[model samples]
Target: MRLRLLVIALLTVSFLGALDNTVVTTALATVAGQLGALEHMSWIVVGYTLASTVLLPVLGKLGDMIGPRPVFLSSLVVFMLASAACGFANSIWWLIASRVVQGMSSAGLQLMSQTIIAHATTPRQRPKYLAVIGAAFPVAILIGPLLGGLITDYWGWPWVFWVNLPVGLVALALASFAVPRIAGGGRARFDIAGTITLTVGLVALVLLAAAPGQGVMDLWMLALAVLALAAFFVVELRVAEPLVDLRHFANRTIGIGIAISAIVGVGLFSITAYLPTYFQMAYRTSATVSGLVPIATVFGMLVSNLGTGWLASRTGHYRPFPIVGTALGAAGLATMAALPVGLPLWVPMAVMAVVGLGTGAFMSLIVAVVQSAAPAGETGAVTSTVNLVRQIGSTLATAVIGGVIAAGVAALLPVGLNAATLTPQVVHAADPALQERIAQIYRDVFAPVFGFLAVTYLIGVVASVLMPRGRLSDSSDVVPAAESVTA
Candidate 1:
């Protein structure tokens, strides 16, 4: 009963985290138009991702030392408050600031949910819970954009953020009642040096990636990001209780899982971010209609996630799923890429559902593999690492594809347009002819950007080939809580 309650709490938390990502996608145009900063709108999404990526490992380790319950509750408080802040934001900067806090909260929610399930349930039960948690992501991903579109089109943009408040409060109330006070080792000493090094390195990398290639020609940003990452590695090797244990990568199955996660992240983020643009440009659909594609994807994920869990339980085998899933994911991506600019309206949506099916088939399988492979105490750290890679993958996709879009815009636009003039305010301030030119450039650039995403999915296909065959139920391997790094 306690475990069941924990599952319910985790599902709610997972939904909140996943919902935020897509909730703003459809509303971004409105936000930009209102704030008069269309050029920087991408950062609103990127900021949350960057914050979440940097903190995932640290938060996971924090959960292991202090216990997942308190950490989770604290994260919920921060997320809910940030949601309120976002709803009330008067400027883009305020919205970005609130998103940063929300992102950090997201990291905690994701890690704690995983840890809570791992600690409370046995391995056999994990697949079912994993299915539920896994479904939350695709479901939220699908709903966020559609909901954002509907709310923005009818009610207003603020409702996007406002919607989270009531849902978060309900989750908080349920968690308070359901969460256990499991005592563990007190708060472990955090690795300050490692934390700073990793944070700086990742932030630098993301910022550099976010910058339009034509805007600043500084290769130094790339160099600095590399240096910071190197420093993090050195600090981690020497720390007594490193936030991320490097030794875990020695496990082949775990390594494969992380690699696959990164590639999948890259593919997933690119598809979601760019698909709406495609629908708007190619199909000339309304924002609400464009947002419906995710619904199709999520519908597929919901079914496949449950099906994967059921199959794993019945067969006591898991490797074949990743192998088949990645292949299908790649095929779906390729199909998306091949879609003619004039393809039937429903074709893309169907393809997205196929892609989601592939995602559902493998999402939990990889997490389960990594968790099963890690020593018990280190589960949080290990789980965090895998998740971190995925976050990094998403960041990279956004940066790279977005950069490509920016570059394409710079080249294609008439001589008058620069970053400043591209702002929605500046664009509106310009003559109608210039606005037409800028709009054309945005449309022209997205096609190739989406093509690049397809390649990333193909890479996932190769990584899936490296996945190891294992079933948790078959092996009674009990990794103590102290040893499992929650990757």
Candidate 2:
């Protein structure tokens, strides 16, 4: 009963963590209106994401050093406080600051969730629970925008933050009572220099991705980011107790696992990244309506993740899922690129469903793959690093594919009067001829983005095929309450 409650609490935290990412996306316009910071809107998201990405590896190391219980509890408390602070913010900058704190704490939430489950369950049993936990991400993302829009419209933007207070409190309570206090062993000293350099590099990279179209400035930023990250690796090698076991990075299982994780990360972003703009521009869907569009993908993901998880648990065979999943994912993305703009809504929904099905199967097994491949003491490190690579991939997709979309849209826009400034309202407000032209422009812009995504998905398929095979190991040394880390 206690374990069940703990699992529930952990899953709740995961849902909340995922919700934070997309919840603010839909609330941006409303929040900007009230705070009058329309120009700085993206910071609300960029700050949280940058902070979260930077912390994943760091906190994973901390979890191993001091034990996860204290770190996890502290994070939960900080998040609760941050949520309350977010609700009472008077300006956009204040809210962004609160989000940064929330991001710091929330960064460890999902990682701890997966790590805890690994502690509690055998590898064979882990997948079913992990798959359910995996489902929370896409589901929360699917509902976040819609939930945010509804709350912002009906209750107010403050309620968006306020809702977290009750759920977080409940999660904190359950975790306190149920989560076992694991004692730390003698892990080597912390690598402060590696941590600092990594932070500088990741923040710069995130800023570059989040910043809009800075030409020469972007090049300089990229160089700094590369230098900082490169220096970080060098520092890690020299450190007594490195942040992670860099030696294991070359292990076929770990290396291939990270490669697969990064590929799927990019593939997933490519397909879903521009959907809202596509819906708004081409179909004239309301923000509320477009927010719900991802639900189709969520549905596909949930079914496949759960089903394959059951099969993997029964058979202890994990390779086939990603292979078939990525191939199908590639095909689905290609289908999406081939879709006509004027097709019935069902067509796009069907394609999204296919894409989601593929991604779900591919994604659910990532942690499992790494955990099975990693040695007893290094599971946390491998898991955290794999997730970090995935984050980097998403950032790369945002930078590269986002640029493609912008340039494609700009070239497609008709000359003379500026079409870039035309909103759906503005376009509809114009004459029929202009409206038709604007609609055609949306269709033209979508093809290149979708085409690029299809190719990315194909690359994912190749990576999946290249995935290294090893016997799935379920011998986790760190069990809750009493287990020890085996070297």
lDDT of each: 0.76, 0.77
lDDT of 2 by residue, 11-56 (tens): 8888988897778787888887899999988888888988889999
Candidate 2 lDDT score relative to the true structure: 0.77
Tell me the tens digit of each residue's lDDT in model 1 across 1-487: 6556667878988998898878887899898779888887988987887898889888878877776778889999999999999989989999999989999998999988887766665566677778887778877765676688889999899888888888888989888877665444565588899889888988888777666464454477777789999999999999898888887888888888888767667876555666665565455566667767877876876788889876875676778777777777777877766666555668889998888888778777678767777766777788899888887777677767766766776787676557534544455456666656554565557656556666666677777776665666644343233233232
Minimum summed lDDT over a 10-residue window in model 1 is located at 478-487
Query: How many clashes (backbone atoms < 3 Å, residues ≥3 apart in a chain or on different chains) does model 1 have?
Result: 28
Query: Residue 168 in model 2: shift from native, Å?
Result: 1.0
TM-scores, each model vs. reference: 0.83, 0.93
